[model samples]
Target: MFFNRKNLEDHDLRHFYKKLLFPRLVEERMLTLLRQGKIGKWFSGIGQEAIAVGSTLALEDDEYILPMHRNLGVFTTRGIPLSRLAGQWVGKDSGFTKGRDRSFHFGSQEHKIIGMISHLGPQLAVADGIALAHKLKKENKVTLVYTGEGATSEGDFHEALNLASVWELPVIFLVENNGYGLSTPVSEQYRCANLVDRAVGYGMEGILIDGNNILEVYNAIDTIAQSIRQKPRPVLVECKTFRMRGHEEASGVKYVPPHLFDQWSALDPLLNFEKFLLKAQIFSDIEIQQIKTEQKAIVEQEISSAFIETEIQADIQRELNDVYASSVYTSKNNGPSKENSKRYIDTISDALNLAMERNDNLILMGQDIAEYGGAFKITDGFVAKFGKERIRNTPICESAIVGAALGLSINGYKSVVEMQFADFVSCGFNQIINNLAKTHYRWGEKADTVIRMPTGAGTGAGPFHSQSNEAWFTKTPGLKVVYPAFPDDAKGLLLAAIDDPNPVLYFEHKYLYRSLTGNCPEDYFHTEIGKARLVHEGDQCSIITYGLGVHWAIEFQEQHPEYSIDILDLRSLQPWDKQAVETTVEKTGRIVILHEDTLTCGFGAELSAYIAEHCFEYLDAPVMRCASLDTPIPMNKLLEDQFLAKARLGSTITKLLAY
Candidate 1:
């Protein structure tokens, strides 16, 4: 080894050598298989196995480790059966994701290993969330997360580090600087002298080590892990290594300079460690040969067993059923209670308070949500009531906060994430759509979290602040969407969303926070999601709407009593009440779907198409849709009013009635 030896025992050294050799041999076998067309592809961790093996071996068995695609040694060091891992690579049903995903793109709760998503940096924030849970539970567990040098440029990297530092969470951010991110050198990735230097900016301890020296890596990580367990805080470690192979088997290493490869080849981790073992008299030549033979046989036997395993059967129905957890729809009431009139905002706050009291595992996170309440003061006094641990005020990092919420859910904690504004969700859209939305579908992990979205356009906060963005998430699978128009519905729906096993987007209209009032129960209650409420019953024309559109329809009907209108409020959008909608379509052959979103491809489009295709025979006219004009909501009051759908409701209804 190029560095001075630490005080590792002989037995520990032997164990490290065995752990390190397994992945290098496995990568060698896999690359041969790829060339012979026996397997699909390979991301060879030929030279950087030491970082994965050493870091993973240093952590406790219960501590979680998040590894990327190239970190095969992490899975091996964690003692996951080689047969099952091989089965994963070959797309067998015995794999972690049951052939749903390939390679290291799956996590195992049983093994405490969270696999990385294709979008790399989000897992860093997820690690923060997991570390946060360990801190909250007073557990001595630490989370170790890995990323390549190129991924450091992602915003999630900065966000996760910043959040972990501010919260003083127990996380080890390991960057395996393997020289290139898909042929882009570190020179082009970042201008910093070392990746660890960026840790100083986040106010965390930083260290650098020679990744080729497994002894040094193990010792440094062990020391840091011990320190973090005692006093929980994040630490950044940069492992300077080189990627010996291309980014993948298919991509050749043509971009690498021959001289650089020759230099790194001389410092190969496996060769250097083997030389160190012989020089230190830890193992003789014959003993080392025998150990290599034994490991090679173990890898070959696992590969052979994997090859004989049953292939994935073509089961379309089973694949479809796995998209979401089975949810029960029920309208629950504790008991008869005195009715109290409350504003929409108060009902939401009351429901959250009651849920937090019932479920001790519930955590609420957002910007200024603790003492300042939220942007609308919904959680104003929650910090004092629930304590700062449960009621957290996060930094302005939506991506990290959302990802951390996911990580918290993985650790059996229910989280409530409040987006300060609905439009700001774009910052964290990847996490919501890719990570949170697909977690359950990919690995059978329920993302038991609720994201509170303060949505709609009546606030006159201009284009950025004002948007009815429920349509964005409604299209995403493995997610539930709830948009309540009234106070009681908001309260009941918020409660139901909290208790839900799937990720839910609860949209609270900003304008309706203090405007609408209704009778709410004093005790806990849950309104059934996927069910529509008949706000007003009629027969001549049917108005199907949600959120602020429901109020607009009600207002139009109150102003024009001459026209008979059936007002239907769809509380939930994803599993919306198709039965109620069909009933109304048949009763009133004329239909007008209303929404506050833009006209093109709005939720109304889905409703109109459903009515046109399924209830075509019952239609008395071409199904009309009333929605806002295709333009941004202006800051001026008059222009904002013009941009909304309220002004056009009368004409759309009159046209439908005339048809």
Candidate 2:
């Protein structure tokens, strides 16, 4: 209640009141919109408005801030028009996402406010990237991230903090402790009673503040931002607040205990602060009511204007607009561009060596990828070719490794993240799916990064090390998925992915690492992404595949020349060449989707559906699919072969031919 702690004056308190009023008005109006069925599903930042307003007020307009879903208050305080916010909520044209992204998913580049994923943890990494970029560009700005206490448990939380501290980045992690994450309570989630203490493990300082006190939140943010500007280190601030409403509009109070809600409801930041202001004689009840009414009127006017002016047209087309930046991928040739008899490993090894040799911004990072030359020896001689700075080894923190790579990627560096085994990618799925996949889209294609993962099931590697889950990202928008089948294709695509402006998940077939050799060009070359290569020409059927399946289809074509089989390998999945696919399907009349992943919801299934929708008229038969049986890859060599598409390929060909 007293300003002695933060040494604030009555005038400062009045400014705080004004700042808090706008955000609260925005939240209340949005809630009204949600209840009135004007806005779709929504989340409220009602009680926690003080923290958002106070923290945002402490920074300059050019400084960066990444707000989570519940930070509508932060958006308002950062100067997002209430009308625009309402438009976004009601799926109107004036929405930040052009009504594409859900309500509360507002982002503004002009305000220096970055967007984040719906899931937890991504904001922390993106904040780190923003800080790192600022550091690299020699810009005197700090990035502040707002997230719920529940997000702290995610691997990206630790990974981002550790990397930020290690690099001495200028970032502040703000945790809004609202007592609940959806239905789960924070007490049951982690052992640490205080979220701020978790920052200690990362060699950073943190504090727990009374979130109800606007002065406290503002002072804490100002102090941390000043320290970062002067010394450039990361810190965490845990604002102990309460969630007055359900997590979202759809959430009922069924999971919320009556007594628990009652207790937290009593200490609601918004109500307590208003009471404090009244008791301190800083403002009268009538004056407070007047301010509230004025704020509400402003929100109503904005919402009305938004409804009248906003046009909600289909902007989902931009969803694929900046998937990969042009300048980064379009470049001059560095290495020889001729076919030489080389293996897959040879092409990849040379590409890594040459890339590092050419660009100082390019870095190779992974477990044992340095001296050990990676698990499959794809990076042999990398450590010797490039020093420790460029070719580095990492701890067994899979999430941390890739998470740090995400930070480094936007730091003006081209980072090649290698996962030792493709199946182990599960450990880094949060970083990949939650962070890398959405960062570019959220930031309007601000992230420049690439990930190299070795995937495929064969050679008795067992379930953990032998699973193809490319579909995980196929369903996720805004990420480039590349699966190369030959040594030549590998070299070309690797260069292309490395040069790509956005993040890419480059999956290399483990079985094709060395087993399938091709005449790889001796020099580096650029390959057109999103274009499928026509390996063989035929009219009977088109065997659609990527990665190693192209070679398999090539072999199948050699043996089945009488059937006139055609082979098409999709190099990039996200911006897949629908034109090439349609053209091929039209020419062949029959199509068979092939991949090493399990048949259930695999890439083949998606391809079948896509072709069926686009090329149904040209199809002579139902779209056929060939893939591994719905079973985990086994450790036994013979069993593994049987579990994969290898044993079923011949039968699948016969079935398609019969159709």
- Top candidate on TM-score is 1
- How far off is residue 125 in model 2, in Å? 2.8
TM of each candidate vs. truth: 0.98, 0.83
Candidate 1 lDDT over residue span 518-626, tens digit each: 9998788888889999999998999999999999998889999998899999999987999999999999999999999999989999999999999999999999998
lDDT of each: 0.92, 0.78
Q: Least accurate stretch of 10 residues (summed lDDT) in model 2?
A: 322-331
On the 0 to 100 scale, the lDDT of residue 492 in model 1 is 92
Model 2, CA-based lDDT: 0.78
Best by lDDT: 1
